[model samples]
Target: MPHYYLHLYNDMIVADEEGLDFPDLAAARAGAIENIRGLICETVSKGCINFSHRIDIADASGEVLTSVSFGEAVRVDG
Candidate 1:
């Protein structure tokens, strides 16, 4: 299993000191998306959230694995 760090990025970098363990990049990515969803939900309850927020997932070596935008993680059905 490999370790991955999920950082929250918008206008600044919020690093994740403690990373998560995943079997592979695919699994890590899925986990990161779920994290983004959770943040989006929290923002929704807060009344105002910059939909431009994003999640930057990196490997243990600090290399970017993937990025997910807030708008893509959640959607309003209309």
Candidate 2:
């Protein structure tokens, strides 16, 4: 198990003080997406969502592994 941090970046860096344990990068990525979805859902309920915001998944050493945008967290059926 490895610890990874999920930081929110929307003109600022909202760092996660306590990192989570994930088996690997893929798992971390999925976890980040799931968490972001939950956050977006909450924001959507208030009718306030900045599509430009993003979640940055990073390693313990301040290295960004991957990022998920607010727009990507949503699914719009057209």
Best by TM-score: 2
The candidate that wins on lDDT is: 2
Off by over 4 Å in 1: none
lDDT of 1 by residue, 1-78 (tens): 899998989658899999999999888878877988887777779687776888888999999978888777777688
Clashes of each: 0, 0
Candidate 2's residue-wise lDDT over 6-76, tens digit each? Answer: 99886577899898999999898888788878888787788888888988898989899898888887687
State each model's CA lDDT, in order: 0.84, 0.86
CA error at residue 31 for candidate 2, angstroms: 0.8
State the weakest 10-residue window (summed lDDT) of model 1.
42-51
Return the TM-score for each candidate structure: 0.84, 0.85
